[model samples]
Target chain A: MIDAHAMLGDETYLRLDADELLRRMDAAGVDLAVARPMGAGMVVDHRAGNDLVLKAGPRIRGLATVNPWWGPKALDELARCRDLGAVGLFLDPARQGFFPTEPVATPVLARAAEYGWPVMMKTGAYVYADILALAEVARDFPGTTFVAGFGGFADQWFELPMAMRNAPNLMLDASMMWGAGIQQIVDRHGAGRVLFGSAEPRNRYAVVLKAIERRGLDESSRRAVLHDNAARVFKLEGGRP
Target chain B: MRIIDFHAHLDERWLHKPIPDASHMVAAMDRLGVAQTCVYTMMGFYAETPRNNDLLLERSQRHPDRLIPFVTVDPKEGPAAVDELERCLERPEFRGIKFHPWLQAFAPSMLEETMVAILKVAARTDTPVLFHDGTPPYSTTFQIADLARWVPEAKVFLGHAGLADYVDPAARLLRDVPNLYGCYCGSRPGDLVHLIETAGADKITFGSDFDPGSWELLAERLDNTIEAGLSPEDLEAVLWRNAERTLRPSSR
Candidate 1:
C-alpha cells in the first residue's frame, strides 16, 4: 500500500521523523509514503524543511512545499527542492496565508508544471484552500496535475464529488474525508485518479485505511486507490526511491 | 462497549440523494454496535424549519430506543425561531437544539439579540444547543465561545470540535467556559487526542454526523475514536457517559 500524503519533521504541532514514520508504515502495511515537512517548514523556510524531507530513505519520498508569498524566491526554492529529489509540490494555502488561485502563487505553480510535477493543495478549511478554489487553480493550469488533499472534508464535503466531476485534471488524496464520499467519487468518477492518503501523525493510519477498505471496492480498484495511483502521480516507480 | 453518537444527521435528501428511512439508521447503528444517536435534521438546518423538525421528531419516534431527536431553528427567522424552539421542546422527544450558522447564514455575534432569546428558552427548559462550528465568518470557535459565555445558563456543544482547523481555540473554549462542551466529530484523530488532553474528556462527546444510509462513515468515525487510544475511563466518558448526562435535563 502507498500513502499519498504524510508529514515528517519534529516541530511544535506534528512530530515525526523518517524512522518513526517507517515503523508506523511497517505496522500499517504501507510500502511507501510521500513525505512533507510540518510546522515551520510548512509556513516559513521551505528550503530547511525540504532538505529534511529529501533525507528520507527509499521507503519514503519527499514532496516540496514553498510559500508563494516568497514570490520569485519561491520559484527558486521549488527549483532547488526539485534538484534535491523532491518528487512533487505541496502547498497549504490556508496555512501559508495565500489562496491557491491567487496571482502570487500562480508563478510557483507554473514552475511545478514546467517540472512535470503534481501539486497537492490542502483543502476543506480556510476559504482560500477549499475545493472550489482548487478547481479554479486546476482550470488555469491544464498541464499540471493537482491533487486535492483531504478532498473537501468536514465542511465542503457536500460539494466535493460534483466539483471533481467538473475539474478533469484534478485528482484527490483521501485523508480526512468520510467513506461514502470516497465511494461516491470512485463509483461515479472511476478510481484512476483517486489515491489513498493517511495524513498520519495528524490522523491515524488505521482509521483512514479503514475508510478505503470499507468503501466496498473490488481488489483492483482498491489497489488503484491505495497504491497504484499515488505511485504514478509521485513517480515512485522503478524499484526504490 | 456502549456508544451513544452525540451528532448524526437525518434528512429527506442528502446532496440530492434520497436518504433511507430510520430503519437504515438503526441498521447502521446495529452494525457499528452503537446504542443510540442524537439525530438532527439537515432539512431544517438548510431550509424549511418547522416541517422538518416535525419529521425529525416523528422519525426518531419510530426507533426511540436507538435515535434521539434534536431540532433546528434558523435564528435568522428572529422571533419565529424562538417560538419554534419553545414549540419543539413542548414535546419530550426532542432532547436538544441544533444550529448550523454557516449553512443558515447568520453569525452568533451578529445575531446576539435573536440568539440570546432562543438560548434563554433553551436555558429555561435545560436543553443543550449544538452548533455547526469550525468554519470562518459565521461558525468559528470564537463566535461559539462568545455565544456560550453570553448565555451561561444554557449548555452549548461545539459540533465538529473545530473540524480541520481552529481546534486550538475550540480546546481553549472547552477548557475555559463551564457550559461549553466539545463533540468529537469531523476532526482528525490527533486533534481529538489534543482536545481530550487539553480540555479533559469529561465534557467531550463522540459523534458520527452520519447522514441516513452512511453506515461506512458511521463505522469509520467509531474506529477513529477507538484508535485515538483514550484511557478506558476517558473512552467511556467520551463514548456515552457525557452524552447520557447531556441528554438528561438535571445532569448539566
Candidate 2:
C-alpha cells in the first residue's frame, strides 16, 4: 500500500538514511511510499536523501518539499518535484508558519493546481476549521485536491459533518489519530474520501494498520483505504502490500 | 493469546454520537482477537459535566473484565480534578489515572507539584498514572519524563513511545528511564518491529489507536508484529503483559 502522506523533504523530521528507511518501509508492508521532506532545506540537501529514495526503483517515489513560505523556492520545487516523479506535495502551515490561503501562498497554490498536483496540507490539531479552510481553497480552485492530514482532531468534532457536506474534493488521511476518529471519518466521508497514512517511524504503522483491519470495514473498502485511494490521489503505480 | 490494546480512545465523537458501545467494543475486540483493553477518556477534559465521567465509569463498570477504564481529569479544574480522581478510584472499574497535558494545555512539568500529591494518593491507593507522549517538537517529552522521575514509585505509562520516528528521543527516554513504560501506538509497522528488536521488547506496549481508521491499520500492525517472528511470550508481553503490569494497581 502507498502511504499517501510522508515528510521526505525536511531533514529534521525524517533523517532516516534512505536505504534503512526503505527497508523499514518494506518491513511495515508499505509497497510504495509517497513522501516529501518536512520543510525547505530538505530541498537544498535533497540529493543526499533523494538519491536514496529515487534509487528505490519504484519502491519509493519522492515528493519535492516546497517552501511555501518562499514564493520562488516553492514554485521551483514544484517543477522539480514533478520531474522527480513525485505524485503529490506535502505542506504544513505550522511548519511553514502561514495559513494555506494566505495571499503569499496563493501563487504557490495556484501553480500546484495548474500542474494538476494535489496539495496535502498538514493540519496541526485544528479540528474542522483547518479542513474547512482547505475546502474553501479547493472550491476556489476547482482542479486542486486538498489532502488534509490529521483531519479530525478533537476541535473538529462538530464541524466534520458540515465540512464533508461542503467540500467534496477535500480528502482526509487516517495517519495520526486512531480509535473513534477513524470510524467517524469513514462513516461521514466514506472510504473514497479517506486515505491511509501512517506518519512512519514516528507513529508505528502496524498499530494503525491493525486498527483499520480490526475496525471491521469490508475488504473492498479496506483495500481502497489501505492503498487504492492514495494511489489514485497521488497517481502512484505502487502495488499493494 | 489474550491481546491487550494499551491504547484506545473514548471521545465526544463516540459519546453523544453513534459510538461503539460495550457490545460494539467487544465485537471489535473479538474481531481483532484482543482479550482485554485499557480504554482512555480523551474527551473527558473537554466535557463540562460530571455526567460524562459518570457515563464513562458506568460504561466501564458494565464490562469490567474486558475494558479497564483510565479516569481522565483536567488539573486546570483544580480541586474538581482531585474530586473526580477520588470518585473514579472509589470505583473498581477504573484501573488508574489518565492525564493529557497536551490536550489540557498544561505542561507535564507544571503539573508535577500537583501530580506529586496525586501520586502519593495513587501509591497509597496503589494505582498508576498514564500519560500521553508525543515527544519533541509536538509536545515536550521531558514534561512527562520529569513527572516520571519525580514519582519513582508510581508506575507511569507513556503512550506513543515509537512516536512516528520521534523514536530517537523516545527511545532514549525508554532506555534511560526506569519507572517509565512506553506504549508503541504510532504508525508504520516496521517501526514497531524495529523497536521490538532494538529495545528487546521489554519496554514497549502495543497500542492500536483503532476506531480511528476502520481498524485496518491497527490490525496490520499486530499482524506484522507476529509475522516478524516474535515469540508468543514476547508477543503477549507487548500486547498484554506489559500493559497489565503497568495499569494494574495490585500488580505493584
Candidate 3:
C-alpha cells in the first residue's frame, strides 16, 4: 500500500532531529511519503525540506507548499519541487485562509499543469463540499489533477463519496482516516477509491492499516488503495528504500 | 507498555448521560492493543461541580487490566476544589486529576495557592494532575508551567497545552516544563513528528478528543504518528508507556 499524503522529515520541527522523523516513516512501512511545506511560513522551508527529503533519497516523495502570496515565485517552485524530487504539491484550502479555486490560485494550478503534478489539499469531515469550488478548478484544468488530500474529512460518506462519485481523475486520500469517518468511506466508496495515508501525527498508521485489514475489504483492493493507486498517480517506480 | 490516553474525553453524550458507558471504548483499546486509558468526563463542563472520579472507577471494576480513571473537577470554586480533590484521593480508583481550565472557567495561575495546597496533597498521594490548557478559556501553557513550578511534587499533564497555536510553541512548552506532559488529541500532526523526536517520547501521550473530532479520530492520529516515524520503542511510549507510568499506578 502507498501513503498518498505525508510530510518530509519532521514537520513543526524546532531543535528536532530530522533523521528521527524519517526513521518514523520507515518504521511505519511507508515506501514513499509525499511530504509538504509548513502552512505559510515555510515557502522556502518547503523547498529546503524537500531538498532534505530528496537528499535522504527516493523513499521521501517531496510535496512543495507555495505561498499563494508568492504569485509567480510559487510557480517557479513547482518545477523546483520536481527537480528537488518532490512528486507533487500540498495545498491547504484554508492555509492562507483562501479558497483553492480563487483567481489567485490560477498561477499555482498552471504550475501543476506545467509539471503534470498532482496537487494535494487537506479535506476532512465533509470537507468535500467546501472543495467543490476546487473541483471546478480541476474540471477547468483537466491537465492538472487535483487530489482531495483528506477527501473532505470522511464524515457521513454523504458528501465524501458523492464528491468523488464522478471525478475519476480526482483522487481522495484517506491519510487521516480515523474512526470518525473510516467505515463510511469504505462502505460508500470502497477501498479502491480511497488511498491509504496516515496523517502521521494524528494516529498510528498501523491502526488505520489494521482497521482496513479487519474491515470487509480484500487484499487486492487493499493493495490498490495502499500502493497501486499512489504509485500510478505519482508514477513512483517501487519507491525502494 | 501500559497505555495512557491522557487527552480522551468521556462525555455524557458518549453513550448515555450522568455516566456515558462506552463499553466499545474498552473494545477499541482491546482491538488496538491499548492497555489502559486515563479518561475524564464532559459532564463536568456543564454541571456546577466536577464529575466524580469513580466514573473511571466503575470502568476499572470491569476491566482492571485496561482502564485507569482520572478526576475531572472544577478548580474555580476555590476551597471547594480541595474538597473534590479529597474525594478523589479517598478512592484508590483515581490516580490523577483532569481539568478543563478553559471550559472550567478558572485561572490555574490565580489558583496557585489552591493548586499548591492541592498539589501538595497530590504529591503526597502521588496522584498526577492533567489539565486542559490549549483551547483556552483563560489557562495558557505559560501559566500552567508557572503553576507546575510552584507545585514541584505534583506531576502536571497539560491536556492540549501548546496545541491551540499548534507549532513550536506547543512543542517547546511540552519539552521545557519538567512536571508537565502533553496530551495529543485535538492538535494537528503537522508538527507532531518533531514533538516525538525532540521531546523524548515519554513526555507525550495519545488522546482522541473523540466526541469533537469523531469517535474514531484517534485511529487516524495513531496512523499519522506512526507514519511520521519513530522506533518501535518510542512509538510504544507515545501510545502507552509514559501514560502507564503516570496514570495507572495511582489509580490502583
Please report the candidate that would top TM-score against the real structure. Answer: 1
Please rank every candidate by lDDT, starting with the best.
Answer: 1, 2, 3
Q: Estimate the TM-score of every prediction.
A: 0.95, 0.72, 0.66
| Candidate 1 chain B worst ten-residue window by lDDT | B243-252
Candidate with the greatest lDDT versus the true structure: 1
Error of 3 at B151 (Å): 4.4
Q: Is candidate 2 or candidate 3 better by lDDT?
A: 2
DockQ of 3: 0.23
The value of fnat for model 2 is: 0.29
State the lDDT of candidate 1 residue by residue for B76-154, as single tens digits: 8889999988898888888888998988889888888999998898888888999988888898988888899998999
Q: Is candidate 1 or candidate 2 better by DockQ?
A: 1
DockQ winner between 1 and 3, please give it. Answer: 1
**Tens-digit lDDT track for model 1 on A177-210?**
7787788789878998788888888888899888
What's the lDDT of the predicted structure labeled candidate 3? 0.63
Q: What is the lDDT for B148 in model 3? A: 80
How big is the positional error of residue A196 in model 3, measured in Å on the Cα after superposition? 2.0
Q: Could you give candidate 2's per-residue lDDT for residues B1-252 as a string of tens digits?
A: 878887776543654555556666767777879887777765675665356667777776676777777777777666677777787678767777777676667775666567776776677676867677763432455667667788788777677764543455666776778877777775344455655655667888887765532355456546645644567877778887877776756322
Mind giving the per-residue lDDT tens digits that candidate 3 earns over B1-252?
Answer: 445566665544633424335576676766655566666667666564444455556655566655556776666666887888787778777767777776667787767777777888778888878776654346566677667878777788777646534335666767777777777665455456667656777888777664322434555555555655668887788777777677636433
Q: Relative to the unseen true structure, what is the C-alpha lDDT of residue B183 in candidate 3, on a scale of 0 to 100?
A: 73
DockQ of each: 0.72, 0.23, 0.23
